[model samples]
Each structure stands twice: as structure tokens, then as C-alpha cells.
Target: MSTQTASSIEIEAFEPHPGWARQGRQPRIAIIGAGMSGIAAVVKLRRAGYTDLTVFEKADRVGGTWRENHYPGLSCDVPSYWYSFTFAKNPDWSHRFAYGPEIQAYMERTARDFGVLDVTHFDTPVTELRYEAPTWRLTTGRGDEHVFDVVISATGVLHHPAFPDIPGLDSFEGEAFHSARWNDDLDLAGKRVGIIGTGSTAAQIVGEIGPEVGRMSVFQRTPQWMAPLPQKAYSKAWKRFLRLFPFVQTLLYHFYYWYMTSRVGGAVLGDEKAHARLAEACRRNLAENVHDPELRARLTPDYKAACKRIVVASDFYPAICADNAELVTDAIERIEPGGVRTKDGRLHELDVLVLATGFDPTRFILPTKVTGENGVDLEKRWDDAPRAHRSMSVPGFPNLWMIEGPTGPVGNLSLITISEYQLGYVIQCLDKMKRDGLEAIAAREEAFDAYNAYLREGLKKTIWVTGGCHSWYIDKTGMPNLYPYAPQQFRKEMQRPDFSEYRLIHEV
Candidate 1:
């Protein structure tokens, strides 16, 4: 095992110069959200010879969703082996499916290792970003204004919590909070817990609180297909081997990536038989876990596995079969002063309410407003849906790149793989601009439109579109805006910069 000390770099102060024409001042780059994507961008930029970069994080720390969602049984749904950055591998993962703190610590370690934390402006939320033809102008919540040559909006779509607009939800007098913003102070011991929504977060919360609470009632709009996670502690021998031989670790990562990606094509786009097999796996898992016939029946999903994101839990089903827990599939009517009332006129009294209703994923690049050429509002352009060329650049937005951007696919694969590819593409663009003395490079409208159309068509055959389940992957218009159908196709498109698809202006 390689013994290395933690980073000793001191966090730097933000020093802003005048606009684009200022001499002796470096061309500044503003990165919104100090999450995995943003931090990866900074590291890649620095490696590519760009030094003047600033990362803005609204929260006090850098772990993004990991730092925010501190609810009970909060852990990564994806396997830890596949969830991390390809560049930085951790040989010391405690569990196959790591908990929240372990994941957050890994992110912190990555930032510190790359010395990106020093240049980050924590607790500074960007209010507005306007393109001033030659440069970009940014205003933060602190009323500070800064100008930059480029901006990268890595503030991921999943951070913002979305509560259902049910009547009397606001009138609930009891302690209520979203799953993302879990109130840790409210003790669940001997309390009647009413959990809404049956997504990943809901499953985790139910498993955790069922053992502790006096009575746990879970309101399920739709059931979720769950797979058993063979989550176990890493043996000392495995850790030693990984630390000693890094190449072996890399090979393992490649193997895992391909294996995971291969499943997507079959699970998402293959025949109904394949989907049925996955559903059977879920059924078998639930039956084996929960001995109670009634509880197993309630936990069984009617839809296919890939229709919604298949959750992985070792104890979630077993927890539901516990004496204190009960599953309610009826629709919620309203929240009375004391408890939640269902459509069947049943009022289930509860001491605390947990809303695991997921996020407002359609609101991409939110909170941080972006203005393109001629005061073009990015939000307005994406009013119908978020679109981008190769999920990186949009038309009229010059020198602006987004990591984990819209129409990018999400699955068991590592986000670091996509982030690395994007960073490479962005850096190559910047390098070309520097070499040719270019002023700006923006995606052409036709290219951007064609890309979106291609992505939409590709998604039609996938389970997300036809699997009879609604998720954050689809927007308000029932369009898939989050990811592509195939990760390989997306990677191939980002392999080389297509200068023809972009309008480049040279510096005179």
C-alpha cells in the first residue's frame, strides 16, 4: 500500500481583474457547483495548463448530494466499485455498496488530492451569469461581480428537492422534510412514521426507520423492482492487492464498466423476455427476504425492471415484513393536522412525515442563471426541454461547457468516465482557441437541434420511455432529457472536436 499524506495546499483568495482586455491578468474560468463534475473539471483544467479557475459551491462543503442527503440508510445505490472516478480508485472501500459518509469522504479526498479545493469559493452561490460578447459577467449572492473568459455549469440536476403539489401539504403541522433535506433532529424512535413515495430514497428510509419507529406506514404511488446487493466488507487481502498493483485495479474497473454497460442495451432496449427475467429476479429476491406472503405481494412491482431505476437493498424487504411496518399503496388525499389522509378516506396518524418524492431534474443548470449571446436566456431556450450537442455545448453559448449535461445517460457506469471525456473535449477546444488566437466558439443551432432529435429518437425504444413508469429521466412534456440511450455513442461523439458544428470567431 502506498502511504501518502493528505494535501497541505492552503485555500486561495479570489482575485478578480477587469474585463477581457485586462493585461497581465489571467483569463478566468467560473465553475458553478463544487460537486464531482465541477471538481473533476478543475483538476482537468489545471492539468491542461489553465491556472486561473474559480469553483463556486453554495454549500459549506464539496460533496454535493452526499453532503446534503444525510437521511437514515443513505448510501449509494450503485456499487462502490463502479461509482467512483476512473482516475482515482479506492482500494479501501468498506462496503461493496458504500454508505453516504464513505462516498462523501472519497469526494473530499479527490478534491484535496488534486489541489482543487484551494481555488474553490465555498458558500458562494452564483445569482446571475451574463455573456458580454467578449466575456462572461457573474454575480454571486454576496453581491460580488466577476468577469471570466468561460463558465462551466456543473451544478447537477439532482440536488434540488421536489415536493408533490398535493393540497394541504403545506398545512401539515407535524415535522416534515424532503428526503434530500432530512431533518436529523427529529428522532424516529417509538414515533409513527409516514413515508411518501417508493423510489430509492423511500426504500432506504423505510428499511432504516422500520426497525426503530413504533409504527412505519409507507405510502407507495408505484412499486419498485429491487435486486439484492451483495454488499460485504472488503477483506484485508483484497485491499492489499488493489493498493500494491494499480494496473490490476484499472483492469478490474474496465471489466466492470463494460459488464455494466453491456447490461444497459439488454435491460433497457432488449426483448420483453429479458425484462421479465429481471422482474423475476426481483420477485425471487422479495420472496426469499420477506417470509410473509401478504407483505411480499405488496412489495412486488407490476412493471418491468428497467422501467424505473432498479433499487438494490439487502434488508429493505425484510424490514417491511417487520412487526411495526405496513405498506399502503393507496393514493394520498391530504395531510390533516395530525396525520396523512388517503383517497380511501383512511387517516393514518403519524408523528413524522418523510417525503422521498425525488428531485426536480428538468430544471437543469438551475439557480445559476446563464445568459448567452445577445442576452439569450438559457432557461428560456430550454423551456420546452434541455438540449445540447453531445451533452456538452448548446447553440449561442460560446466557450461554455457543462459536465454531466442534459441528455447524458446515467446508469451503473461511473460518472467520472463521462466527466473525463467532457474535460478532455473542453480542454481540446480551449487549446485550439489558444493556438489559433480565437475569440469564441459556439455550437451551431442546426447541430444542436439535430443532436437533440437523434437523442429523442434513440430514447423511444428504451425502457424509460415505454416501460410504463414515470421518473425524473423524463421532463414535464414526457421527454427524456437526462441521458442518451447508449453511453458508447455519446463517448464516440465526444472523442473529437467537430469544428464544422461550431461557429468560431478569431481574434483580430
Candidate 2:
């Protein structure tokens, strides 16, 4: 092993404007969720010389998605090197696409190494948040209460699992569970399996267990456009070299970010040439992989490639084409006691049923009753739709910052990179608070409305709206709950806070 460690890597500190020391005292910070974003927040805050912080995690461990999801073949689509923290780069990822366990290990190691695990209160969920002028009150699940000057909600979007609404689903005699809540004790060898939905999770599970299972019935409500995922193992020699010279790994990280995000960003934002190239790649991948015309037609999607979150898999096609696996396109009328009943009067029998129907993406900072200044309820305010100014601040919530909140960039880019950018932006806002000696800060109502209005218009050009497919990205308001701007533009916008759009408060 190299003598140099992640701590040896020099990280630049945020240089607050001159006269930043005019603030009276550092604020007590409470961070909800010990996920990747929450871990990033703690690291950045401490690096910026703010040590008064505590992290509340509902689980017994860190690594949110990676911790919760552990089904077969669960892996990140983003490259391993690029899907890591800039401060702590891993030189020994097993593959280009890191598996869920590997990613979870990375997260735990990062938290342990950076001292995040020490300050984090695992198994303590924040149930309520109430703004009391300059300070905020946080109530935990254990009936414990804490006061803080600032609260950061890093509660991720995809934490809650969403099961299918098929009738008689609960009546299934077989062992059934959502993909997120996988039953590790159950063995799958020679057992018949039935998977519902054709999203990424279902694709991954089918690809891994198709040959081993006696039979597999994949219930596809809609076919997904699969992009070719080329995974390569990192050689031991390369790993050693990366360990010796970490800067090379950093360079590779930036290169991957630029390469991956540029293609995805352009394609989703209605760039004609980029969209065409991406669509052709997906179509060609399907055509070349599945040769049978009947099977190919069943697997082909009616919508555009980037319309829904593109499923990335190298083994899914071949696994589905295997004799043991059958892709059922018939509409599922209801789940029966022993199997699934389709509208065609066919019953697909199974020993195990897995619902990979995905999560409720809109439940950010929910189940936590949050009351802002002057008796403003966050749930009621966003009854129509979830909206945040610049994806971080709400109009009524003062001294509250959200990382990867509503309207955040949700493209094919690595979420690690996006969360880092948002953390940097949040740090800048906090620094500004100190410089101004402000008691609290919130986004202006007009600014929040205008920013969402701009997002509504910008989404019109994106593939999510015009690509002729319904996706989870669209909110109840018939608008996309994502940032529609280019990746470069997002980075630029997050570099600093636009103070004019905020409502800064100070008491006499």
C-alpha cells in the first residue's frame, strides 16, 4: 500500500470574503440522513472550519441507497472512479461499474476515515422540524428534542419503496418483497421467480438470476430502452499505479464526468444531433443483441431512448433471451394467490415475486412535519407540488438548506458529483450568513415562484416532456421535477449564491 492516504490529498478551503470573522458565533448544525449527500455536507462543513454539527441517520449505517438496496446485480451505472468523493478517491474499485456492496463499503470507509461516523447518531430519525425565529427545533423518533441554528435535509429522494397497485398483490402465496427490501435469507436456486416492472432494478435482477432460476416471468408494463453498459475490471497493476499517483485518478474522474454528462445532458435537453445519436445507440444495442424478431419487438420501446431513465445493462439482453426466462408483455390483470393473472387469461406461476417498481421520488423531507416561520407548514405549502428555489431553499423556511432537494439535476450524471456541487453552494450560503451577521435566511417568495416558472418553461424542450412517455420525473403538476439546464450551466449557477433573490433577516 502507498504511504500517502486520502488525508494526504490537499483540498482547497472556501475563501470567505474579507471581514467574515464579524459573525458572533458559529451556528449549531443538524444534518438529517447520513447518506452520500449528508456525508458530503459534514465533510465540507468541517473543512470550512465549522465543527458544531451533528448528523442524524434513521438507519444503523451510512450509504443510503447503497445500504438499503442489496438485490442481485445491484450496481451503479456511473463509473466507479467518477462516482466517488473528490476528497477521498478509491484506487481499488473492482469494476468500472461498482456493485452495491462495494459502494456501501466505500461510503462506510469514507465516513469512518473522515470522522463522520463519530458525530452521526444512527437509528435516530428526525420526525419534526419547527422554525423558531433564529433557531430551529428538531424532534427525533425517540421523543428527543434538539435545538439548532441550522438544519440540512439530506434525506434522499429515492428512500421510500413504491410497490405495484395490482389487485390481490398481498394475497400472493409466494415470498414477495420490494427490490429495496430484499430477503437475503431466501435461496433462489432452482426456484421459479416472477419480477414486476421493467425498470433498472428488474433488469439487473433478471440478468443475474435468469439462468440459475428454474423459471422467470418478467412482467413488463412498458419496455425500457437499454443502453449498452461496457464494464471493465481494473487490473491490479493499474490499481497499484493509481495508489502511487492519485492525481492521475483525479484527472480520469474529471474526464469521465465531462464525457458522460455531456452526452446525457445534451440528449435529454432536446439537442437534435445528440438525441439522435443516443437513440440510435439504444436501438442498435437492442437490434444487435436480440436477433429473434418476435422477442425483439416485445423488448423494443415505443418511446424515445432518453424519455425515461435509460436502463444500463450488458447482461440483461442475453439473460432475457435465455430459454429459462420469458418476457410477459400481456397486461397483468391482478396478482393471484399462487401467481400473476394476465388479461390474456394466462397465469404465470412463481415461487418468489419481486416488485422492482422503484421508489416515490417526490418524498423529500417528508414524514417529517416541518413548520416554518409564522406557522407555515411545508407539507401544506407544497400540497400541489414540491418546489425549491434553486433546488436548495424554500420561501418560508429560514436557516434551512437542502442538498439535492426538489428541482435538482436528475439526469444520467453521477449523484455524487451533483451532491458535491450542491454542498459547495450550501457552504457559500452559510458563509454569506456569517459575513452579513444575519440571524436567518430564506429564498424570497417571488424568487421561488420565478425560478420554478423558469424551470417549467425550460422542461418543455427536454425529452422527459416531448418524448411521448410518462416517467417518474414528471410531478403531479404535469411538470418535470428536475433541472432542465445543461450540466455546465448547473455548475456555474451553483458556484455562488445570488444574494438578491434571498430574504435575509436580522433582529434589532
Candidate 3:
């Protein structure tokens, strides 16, 4: 690939191969999710000469999470340099941490520029995915069924918003909604707002609404550890330099990746010194922003860093300290007509309610009905706790690959990197199938079980499992199905196709 600005590239329509028109022999692949990861898969596969492909997106547009979550103050915690796809780096990042709209626009542009949009089926959600004897069958929400030789589930975990099932949640007379599904019609000017669950979304929303609302009551179950974000607009000179010197840009990306991945390792497996330093920095950040001792104490996190995601914002603590905002640490008992009632029987009056609770990360590629061999449901097979070999292939699901699958990397590291790596692996598998005339490829049961056990053992030592905090990363059984501590080791394991770990059935 040449070193050019993402905007400079023009997308051309893909022409079908002569073999595609043949009576019975071309391989077809269906990719679910037209997000960054899914687009990456389509681009890579097309470049590798797999012409028969289709991308299905549930929404009318591309950019999965970015297209869905349009809440105020919504932005990526990761730096823009690392957050984007490596193959298509943007030299013109406005902020160090790009906002949702900008990121969404980038994805949309990527799809358009790469011709993935032409092949993508928008406003279509896959209702059912079944594996026939030799091909995978898919049913859309519109009651249309299609078959493919292989399937790739790039449908990410974060897109599905998980609302809390609190008592009397439905009876709240006030305008209440999840942060993912922000209600734009409800005006907050001079209106009291009760925000629930001070996670990343809650922090961002509170900061955004604090200056506008009459009074902002932020409800917190556990305080999040926030870091200072060095967010600033990039200069035109910086973009020029990045474009002129591609090597420098690569070096910069590597430096950021190494630094971030090292921090993840330090938090998950390194000595206590690193964790303590991070904790001290978090405390100093909180103390500097919040003047009141009570408020500072309420904002301090008790668990270890990386147990739950560490938020990055320069304004969140300061916003909470504002006169209009008040942080309530007490558990919410129920939703009264006017406001929320805490466990201590105190009714905090509010006009609007915002649930900033996070997404359902444990339920990987969920809500999409996927059936495998012999009409076996993928959900029932996993039993709500999905497992995958190298977070790619399931035991019984043949020729089905999942990018950013269960137990895949979740923290600090760039998801773009994980997606690229997974896509590469999937393409390689397809290449092998084409070369060897294989009909299907399924993970060996022993290898799948062993990989899951290894992942479980690694999670046992991490702060996400041992720490006294509950997060979306954990399943109902409390297993951490996100990232592992040794990301590099995992990457190396996925560098090539491990045929021994999988069962490859040749075409008869």
C-alpha cells in the first residue's frame, strides 16, 4: 500500500470474476457489521482477490459504535493516532482524543473511499445465521435468506447498549434514557438532571450537562479512576511532517502502542509499584480538580487500576466540583415521580434522568441469531458465555471467524490493531481453503477447550477478576472474557494458521 492521505484514495466498483458466473463453484463470504473492523475485513479481503463478498450493517449507515452512540461529550479515550486503522492513518486528527462524530466520519469516509460501501447492505440486520452441510445460511430481519461459504462476525460488543434492570425503572415520570440512546428532544436547560452509574459515559455526560442543567445529581455505585487527558488540536505542520515522513509516523505509532500495551501489562501482571504509581497519579488528579474533601473522597476509586476501564478527561472532576453539580454515592433505591430515592430514604428531585451504564461486553456478537452445524444455535452452545480459539473460530462453527471476539483484547491497546490482526488471520484461512480445496474449517474441541482454560488461568491473576470491582468485562459467572495480560504472546500465536488446532475438511 502506498503512503497517501486517506482522502486521496478513490474507491472503484468491484467487478465480479468470470468464475463467479460459473454454474457451481465460486466461494462466497458474508461479513456482519460495517464498522471499522468489518470495513477492515472487507478491504483486506478484496485486496487479496476474494471478489465474492458482502457486508451487512444493521443501521442505515456505516461506523458501528460511532454511528449509534451520539451522546453529548462522547469521545474516544484512546489517542487518535492509535485509535485508527494502521493501513489508513489520518494525518488530520483535530483532537488528541477524537470525538464520536469525527471518528464516525472517518469510518464513513473509509467505507466510501475503499469501495466497501458499494458492497455493504445497509439497514439490514442478520436475524439468523445457520450453517448448512457445506455452506452458511443467513436470514435478515427483512425475511431474506442468503448462503455463503464462510461468515465473519465483526459485530462488536459495545454497540449493544445494556440498560440496568432497576425496580420501578419504567414508572419514572421524568424523561429517562440510557446514555447510548440519548434523548435529544428532552431539553436540560435549567432542568434538574439525575445521572446514574458514573462510568465513562456518565462522566462525559455529567461534564457536558453540568454547566447547562439547573442541578446535576450524579449517582455513583463505584467511583472511576480518571486520568488527565492531554487533549489538543493538531497543527497543520504536524500533518505535513507525518505525510512527508512515513517512517516517522510508523515510529510514533509503535511508540504509542508500546507505551499503552506496557501500561496494560503493568496493571495486569507487573509489580505493585507500577499499580501504586498509577493510583497515586489518579488521586493527585482528583485532589487537584475537586476542592471539597467529601467530594474528593467520593470520586476516589478503591479498586486497582485496569480492573475497570480508567477514564481520561480533564473536565470531569472539575465539572463535578461546579456549584450546579453534586455527586451522590448512595445506592438508588427506586425512581420516584419527581426524582430518585436513595437507600437512606432521601429523594433527590430531578426533571430528567440519564443512565450512563456501560454496554454488554460479555455477550459477544449477541442478539443476532446464529445457528451452526445441524441447526445448533450458537448462543445455546455457548450458554451466554461464549468461547473461541484465539478469539477467532468456535469449536462447532465452520468457516465462521469473529474479529474482536470473546477473550480478545479490550483495554488500553488499540482495537484497530486487534481487528487488523484478526482480519489477517481470517484472510489467511480463506486462502488456505481456496488453495487446499477445503470445504470447511472448525476449531478442534481439545484445542478450543485448552485455549479457553489458558485464558481463564490468565484472567485469574488480573485485577479485573481479583479486584473488588464489578465491570461489564465479566460474565454472570464472573469470568473476564475480554483481553489477556500477554497481548504480544497472543498476537504471535495468531501470526499464522494453526491447522493442527483446527479441523479442516476437504471438498469432496
Candidate 4:
């Protein structure tokens, strides 16, 4: 038998149950990862009247990143009102930036209330997905095989933790772990703590635990552009008023979305004035906060702001300025049994070592063998670089969609809002399939290539490409693997699916 291209494939349509009529028919949908995106899919699909769906999660619970990272002072940099679901807004957020636990609890409550928990397969990870014309065969970790008409991969980017490769890293005698995999059992109070990587997670930890820890050493490889958080709690009256008049909460959500997207979006998109203003704010924050000239200079970032997703924390500078906290700018030589040894021949002793190194952004829904038509492997296709058509669908992958996938807009803005937009587009495509009696649909290769080309050209105008700093956003191809346009443009693009861009397979 000869293999067929996506455009050339045609297959038998889903047959309706003999007992049930055509109106009662529904496609079996399998959504991977019970994180925010997965939960959003469940709620949105169920409400849209598609009930035959199941979520497979590796972890025992919902809330992907939030559930994983429980480090102290782990709150969202985005405003709480904007970070939450647009459909289900929480009026009672304790602070402007919701804590990790609060976001996790919100996810659980959303899942529970929306009946997602019932349909979700907890602790079950999708090991592989194979497209066998018309349908997708899903293999779970338990060796269970399930076939579905459609599969949506909601496995997020930050789930896999990236560890720093240093000689004798394992030789450290003290408890060591990634920031995402925080050890709740260990008591950090009065303990000599050393944090590697001065990313957002490390800054948050330093801000929260610096005062209490006996001695804190923050090993900074590169300085991050620090932005003022200006986080504050909601008053009792404000909460009560929002609960009474929910429209006010909705108004606040839109306001925040506009504020963040326009400001941050413009800055990254090479708006010189906007970028300069933002960079100035960060510089002013560092200079005004850090009294010592040397410390201020050490804290200042040489690259353009928004290059590495500017670390937002009002308390970080103050925490670093504290008497107990010491910022070590020296390069790390190796890790001894007791602590981290720098190239300056200074050994910093620590009782606990925290690796605040972030995740490998490229490993989204990867390591899972996804074979499309003609046994085209997704991993191999993306071996050099990962690219998805408009950040949702891939070429040759029929009846499959990815939420918050490659080339999606991810930065200081709220991802929940972006995921919702992407989901809206996915649902529309699914609707077309159900309505038009289609067996399979994949992005046209020409269309995929064109869209990706457009993204690369647009990225040329963005700071991610122009900025001198190295960031996870830039893939090996020297192209930033994210939406480089403004959020409004992204929203406008996702507003409607261009049917011509897809290779739709009609049922035989």
C-alpha cells in the first residue's frame, strides 16, 4: 500500500449509533494534560454541548504549573483579574497578583464546579498518539489504548524542569531540587540557603525567604530587568462590591487585558518609545531601590527590557539589599559536597540548594511519539525547530490541535487569556468538522510554511530578535518561537479560521 499526503487522504465518516439519531451523535474527543488549558477545553466544550470528552493528566490533580511550583512568594506577575479565566472571574482574589496556591485552588474549583474532574483521567499520561486515517489512537501510561475522533494536546511548555549542568552538581550533600519541584517537608527558616539562576523563581524565593534565612547566596549568571510589581490586596468592601456587582469585575478584567497587552505588546514589538519607557522604568527601579552603587550596577541588566521576560517583583531588590542576602556575581566553578564553589576560589556554604533554572521551552508535548499519516513523526519533523501553523495545528497531523503550543504568544501577559483565544479557534474548526461531515483535517503545508514565514518576518521587528540577550524564546534557528505581533493582532487572527488554509478530508 502506498502512503498518502494529508490533502490526498479520504476516509469513512463516523457512524452514528443504530439506536440514536444523527442529531444525538457526538465525536469522542481526548484532551491531554489536565492543566489550565485542558481544564479550559473541558469547560468550554461541555458548555458548547459537546459532552463526549476526557482529559488525561500525568499528575494526580489539575493546575499544571501552579500545582507544581509551591515555592514561597510564588504569585503571578500578571494581575489576578487578568490572569483568571474570562468566563469564570474570581472577585475575591487576595491580592492583585494571585499566589500559586490560590491559582491552583481556582483551577481545582473550576474543574470541580464545571464537572471536569468527573471526565478527567487523573494520573494518566498520554504516552503516544497515532493517526490511523479518520481517527486517532491514544496510548496511555497504563498501556490502555483509546481511540478518538479528535485529540487536543494541552500539555504546556513549563512542565519539564531544566537543570543546570555543572560539575559536581550532584556532589552537594544538602537537599537540592528545582524550584518547580519545591520540597514542602524541608524547613528553610534560619537555614543557609543558596539559589542558582536569578530568574523570576529565584527572585521570588530571595524576596520571600531572605529575611528569615541565616545566610543566602544568590548565584547570578545574568542580571534580569526588574520591573515593579506594585502588588496589593483587595479590601473587604471592594470584594463585597465586586461580588454584588459582577459586571464591575468583568470590566476590571478587560481593563487589565488591555493595559498589559498594549503596554507589553508594544514594547516587545519594537516600539522604540514604548521600549525605552519600559527600560527606563526598570533602570529607575534598580537605581532608586538599591542604595549601594556596586549592588545597583550588579543588578542592572545590559540587554533591552522585555528580552528575557522582565522579572516583576517589587520586593526582590529590597530582599537582595538585606544584610543576610549576598549577590554572588562570580562564575560558578563547581558544587562541592557542602556548597557551591565559584571561580573566584570562594566556597559558599549552604544547607539547602535551590535550582531556580527555568524549563526547556522547546519540549512542548514532546517525548510523546506522535505519528501522523504515512508514519510521519512529529518529533523528527520538529527535530531542528518546532513550528505550528498559527500556534494551533501542524501539517500532516489530521484531527489534532494544540493549545498554547509552539509560536504562541507567551510573555508577561496572561496565558489564560491567550489559551482561551486559541481554544475558541479550535472549537470553531471542530464545529466545522462535525457540521460538514469531515473525517480529517490538517493544515495545508503551503499555508503552514507561509504562516511561519510571516511569523519570522514579523519577529524581525521584535525585541526578542533585536535584543542582545539570549532567551528561551529564540530557538536554534535564530527565530523566536512565539507570536511577535501585538496581542490585538493575535486576537484578530484567532477570531476566525481561514477554511482555505486547511486540507479538509470529506467522509466517503
Give all TM-scores, in the order shown: 0.92, 0.95, 0.92, 0.94
lDDT of 1 by residue, 54-144 (tens): 8878877788888888899998866677777876789888887789988888998988888767777777789998877667788888787
Residue 88, candidate 3: Cα error in Å is 1.1
Which candidate's lDDT is highest?
2
lDDT of 2 by residue, 127-188 (tens): 99998777788888878677787899999889999977899999999999999999999899
Worst 10 residues of 2 by lDDT: 1-10
TM-score of 3: 0.92
lDDT of 4 by residue, 1-508 (tens): 1111222222233442221112347778889988899989998888787788878888878888988889988999888988888778898899999888888899988887777777777767789999877778888887877778789999988888999999999899999999988998888888999999888998898999888899899999999998899889889999999999999888889898888877877899988878888899998998889999989889888888988888889889998999999999999999999999999999999999999999888878887899998999999999888889998889999889999999898874578988899889988887887777677789999999999889889888888878888887878887768888888888999999999999978752
lDDT of each: 0.78, 0.86, 0.79, 0.85
Better of 1 and 3 by lDDT: 3
Clashing pairs in 3: none
What is candidate 2's local distance difference test score? 0.86
User: Per-residue error at 58 for model 2, in Å?
Assistant: 0.3
Q: In candidate 1, what residue range of length 10 has the lowest lDDT sum?
A: 1-10
Off by over 4 Å in 4: 1-24
